[model samples]
Target: WRLAEKAAVTLVDRLICDLALDVDRHSVGETYLAHRPRHAGGFEKEAEATQENYGVAPEILTQSQLSSAGLAGPFYGAMTTPIGFGLNPRKYVAGLYKGAFAAGTRFFDRSPVVQINEKGVTTSQGHVKADKVILATNGYSSEDIPDWMAGRYMPAQSTAIVTEPLSDTALEAAGWTSDQMAYDSRRLLHYFRLMPDRRFLFGMRGGVFSSVSTEAVARTKVVSDFREMFPAWAKVGISHAWSGMVCLARGRVPFVGPVPNMPNVLAGFAYHGNGVAMGTFSGQLLADMALERRPALYPAAMHHPARRFPLGRMRRALVPPVYAAYHLSDLRR
Candidate 1:
């Protein structure tokens, strides 16, 4: 938790200090253990560490306070500000690309990379040789890449479902008027947020198998779980459902450094689902490394090369059993 807080603070600092981006950040504080009291002590310890390190003490709210805020209660609560905010990634990326293009950055859309060697990257149309090549492909990396990358990263799928726009009365009934992003404490957790358009975005970690049948089953389960949790909005219809891959390293940490034995080639990936902020920090670090800048910001562990997974190609087959175990554990909890 401390490491994550530090990394998040560092990213926000860099965005404000170096990039001069006017991030529309909000301070809709988060709540933990809102329905469970057994985990209160551990949560209090976490809040204490966060306060000591970041100078922001989290407030422990009671059931009455949570209910007054239109939240389902029987929870041991802790609230921390300057930690919860939502950014429109689409706008951010568009602005970034526009600036990059204005600064002479070229775009080669739809041109898939065919290979990456000591010389440079090879595209389907042609080869573009360069002195330095930075591979930033996360979960969507091509199979033709180096053995180390193929063996080290496991691409897992994450699924989400968003509802149609809800009326104010419906939102109130669901106890979701706060508009704060929230996630529950569970082995296989559920994350949700109230969108600006009054719709709700509910997501969970599943869909590890890429087959159509498996995805359909996972989607059904997610919808069922959402309905079960938000029974007040039982009649709310799902407008969209989607899934995407997330790269996970064997040690469950991101890596940013030179590929062993691959001269002039650097790779950064395996975000473990916290991609937005962590990826931004990684890109900055990679840029510094490319320019031979001194005094890197992140830790040595983050810069270390990722260790390869055993039975690399067959790792995907283990998803079902792994998810089953996690779900079973959640039930036990």
Candidate 2:
């Protein structure tokens, strides 16, 4: 976890200094708000650990302090960690893409990798042979592409909704005008933030299937949960709603190392939904490994390979029962 913190810090520094990409909707600090009394104690423990380990002081907010922080709901208390930040991901990625192109990185669009081997990869259009290859594909990975990816990663769906820009009066009514990124203390958590444009972005994890009808159902579920969490915005119109897959591993941690039995092939995935900074950090480590150089931040957790999940291709069947248990646990007082 400390290494992950370092990765987040390095990511922020590189974005501001090395890339020099000025983007909007970027702000530091986050609060892990607790909505239940049972969940409040964990915040204090987290704050103490963070401060003691990293010398970074985090504030633990009381119930009254929650209101002062511009969050309105049933939250009991919170731990505001001043480590990470929230940004417009689309803008950040665009800037990164432009910067990489400027740095002479060749990009081949419309070419989906069909196979990967020690020599290189075979894409839909043509085969590109190289001495070393990196399999950075996360949730969209194909099981048969390398055969090693099967049962080693799990793709879970996360849905999000964006409200129409709220008026000052609306924001005041909700008492949630702050722009800090925040998430509740639930196993299946909900992350939200007020963007610079006054739009409220709320996201959650309840999806287990991928289809048109299932997507609609997931959207409805998220919207319902959003309205339930913030009653003041019950009537607010959602301008947009979407869902995407995030990779997960059996070990519940990220893996960034060479593929088993394939020395020239390196793979990195399973960020558990924190693919922004961790993904960038993993890419750097992969590059270092490819060049046979020591990485600046290659922790033991990351170096450890991910074990394959049970039931092989049928592993997705494991989600419903697990989600059901999580839902029941979150409902407990």
Candidate 3:
């Protein structure tokens, strides 16, 4: 958690310094509360230490404060920046793509890579070899290409749902006036944010497999959880529901470097759901490596070689049991 927090804060600081995009960031710190009283003491102590180290106090909010923030909880503590911020991801990516296109970057859409070697990639259109091949395939990577990459990371599923635009009165009724993004302190955590359009986006970690039935079950659970969290929005219709895979590495950190024994074949992946900033930053590091530029801003851990999963070919089959264990542990939390 410390490493993750440091990586996130560092990336956010770099973004702010570069003026990369209008992140729509807010300093309204996130609240971390639990329904169980046993969790409060540990959280309070941790929050206090974090506040002291970061110079941003983690206020121990009361029940009224938590309620006012649209959080359903027994009061605990809240941490401020550099942990609190919000951004419009769509606009950020769109802007980057537009700029890249203008800079004469020809995008070959729908040309899926069938094979990758040290030289280049063989796509659906045909084989077009090059001097170096950069494998940026994260969660969607196939096992066929570069046998070593297979089973190197666990691709876990994450689900999200968004509600129809709620009115100001509806927002107030839900006690959600703050624009800050919020998440709980569980291993299988729930993340949610109120969009500028008045819609609420809720997400969670579940759905070990990617299938219609799995997605349906995940959606049902997420919607139920959302309703439970914000009773005022219980009747609100869900506008969208979706799910995607997030690559998980052994150390919970991303890797950006040449594939072992295949130096020219550089790869960058395994962000573990922190792809928005970590992915972009890793892309830059990969580019630097390809271009033979200076060293990266991040530590060597960010560029370490990925450790292969022990299950090998049966890795995907083990996802369900792993998810169940994590879910059971979260239930205890």
Candidate 4:
């Protein structure tokens, strides 16, 4: 697991450097700042184990140190980890698309795969013959496309809001002027960051259902949480707000291997919402498998296939109660 984690970061680094991609990547740092004292100890233990196992050093900061680090609020303490950075995921993905295109990878836009057999994929546009097909879609996957994908992946909605660029005065007023990406230690976590452009991005985990009405409610809840965390910026104008699905597996691990009974096909999904890096890493692994080349890194932890959820099509019904339980657990702090 430790080696896989290290390799995941290395793979992304190699992709950016080898492809000469400009992704607006930042190497500032990341902090897991906790708001509750009980969570602070867990952070300390994680920092120690992560440093020992992964060789990335982390500093455990006291409450005063957290405030000194330009984060005001009722934080108990924090564990600031090195070698982790922030990047513009859109730019990174666009860069990948351009690089792959330049390398002679043909793309068919709006051609959703309606069927996948041993020979190729059939889309609404037409059928494309291929020696090997890879299913890379995570949250948007259709269960019936391969039938085996059903009940093996769960999609949950996550919402985020970006504020209009904050002025220096507002930054100081809120005491959150750092460019470091940070999140609190809560079961229902809130990940936030002050982007290079000075816009604050705040996101939260929840939303079992996805719909026009549910999205509005999720946006409202995220805004409420953001305001509660940073009261000084409660009146800030929000420039953008949106929601998207993040995939999960019942096993709580990712799956990257051949689709059952499909010899010429491979599928990878269920990143548990940490897709940017892990997805890239999985793509490399799948490519290696397709090419019959030895994989640079493949951990036994992620080698197993994902298990099916109990409720099948009704698996979404299971999320709300689990989310409610997490909410109640978070309230205990």
Candidate 5:
């Protein structure tokens, strides 16, 4: 922080000397003293060394490479951003996996398997058997289980954006040459950083998003957002806006492993937006559990079978009043 302050003052001096073209000895002396920049961010302290342990950068598997048969669908890419400019470097990454995954295992089970229809009613057709049954649906799941197991899942969204490349002039003006990810502190927070290419990607929570969304809406929000967050980026444009449906548990933790009492069936998902790391973590742990027969899984509040909040019409009626009261309590910024 102290270093940043010193550099900020030096920047102002350079601006006055170059832009204002203040060359006179007396004018230069006065400008140097008066033009020192004040710290807009109250960065008061500095910390020492920190350590990180990052693992492998996993490869992106394609349709042909999958022995398990990849989904036939569209492929997309994006960038994420976190808003806090000077602090919280990893807040964005704190919620992602740079690259991590474990190799898949093959199973040739021929015993018996059970088939449940879309309605979830078990049907007695053909053979009901399999040596093993695994549910590898990672997030974005919606299926009804028994009342006892209903609390074990969810479906939520993750929104992200990517910007067109910035010009050198624009980059200099923004003074964000150091490309690092960032995010801010909010219950529903925004996270972002830069990309391998020169573009920026920012992501945040809270928005009703879908695949049918239009480019106009995405670019409008992103470009308007660019003007506000980065006024110097006048020529920049938004190239894309996309969303991923992530799973969540009530406790905001991953819901992994076998369903409490379900026989032979195993499940792994419920990332809570921190999946890149936790998802793989759960995978490794689950593998270990299956091999060693230790704890098959952890309890998530979402899986807490006993949770009963206001639902249906009651939720519709009670939420507005409670939400309005929350907004009413906000101070005039």
Candidate 6:
């Protein structure tokens, strides 16, 4: 929390300095302090609206900060997938949009759309009647969503697990204190991060799961898959494992903002793993557009949901081969 907040403050300080063509970094810092002066008293601090950078924090590379810092990828602001959201989601709850308290209201069945509005939540199932409609469903989508949208999104499942707390010795070995979340560059990655309680929560792409596994059932072979990330738990049994349904898109980017057609009715879904923030950001945009209000501060071209994908079990069959080829390509690269 401290480091993230510090980074945010520094970012703005530097940004203002850059914007006005200030000469020195320290000079900008002094200006920032003067305008947004802080009193090291009993007051709470502010957080940065957004974070910058894509690589791991400097301190994290206890062994090599200087080199590792630059020997990395650019930040997409996607806390879910550091490699960018192509086929996977980031590890943590990098949610930018916190849903409104009025989430499950009756507003969905009306104007904005005639059928399958923002969410799959609706009272009617028959052919929807309205001026126009949009298919915002990503993975859990139904045939009811427009033919175009259905073609665009391919729903898939992902699994995640929070591990047993880390031991003091384990922490010493890992050497990371802050819980900055991280995920890798694979279509299926074992991305994870630290928690204040010292537990390492890990997540990855799991094949379809039809039934739920109890805690006892889940805890059976826990240490195997993730032991490589932290071999310290070789002998420690896995406390638990659980699975859930997550969506994936054609390119993995959320179909935010607006597109050419389907006016009055706006669409936003297919978050890939960027759903949290993307959802919030998209939802806010949707609400503003619906309310006939324009947000001064937000991204343009965000409400546009992707063009849908074709329906069929063909997706499932083709996915294995496609993903395998993709992974093989990665190996070669």
Best by TM-score: 4
- Provide the lDDT at 259 for model 3: 85
Give each prediction's root-mean-square deviation over alpha carbons. Answer: 2.7, 1.4, 2.8, 1.2, 18.0, 13.3
Pairs that clash in candidate 4: none
Query: How far off is model 3, as Cα RMSD?
Result: 2.8
How many residue pairs collide in each prediction? 1, 0, 1, 0, 16, 22
**What is each predicted model's overall lDDT from 0 to 1?**
0.73, 0.85, 0.74, 0.87, 0.41, 0.44
Candidate 4's C-alpha runs over 4 A off are none
Write candidate 3's Cα lDDT for 217-255 as tens digits. 989999998888788888999999999999988777788
- The TM-scores of all predictions, comma-separated, are 0.89, 0.96, 0.88, 0.97, 0.53, 0.57
lDDT assessment of candidate 5: 0.41
TM-score of 6: 0.57
How do the residues 240-286 of candidate 2 rate in per-residue lDDT, one tens digit apiece? 99998899999988899988898879999998898887887888788
Which candidate, 1 or 5, has the higher lDDT?
1
Better of 1 and 5 by TM-score: 1
Candidate 1 Cα deviation (angstroms), residue 74: 7.9
Model 2 collision count = 0
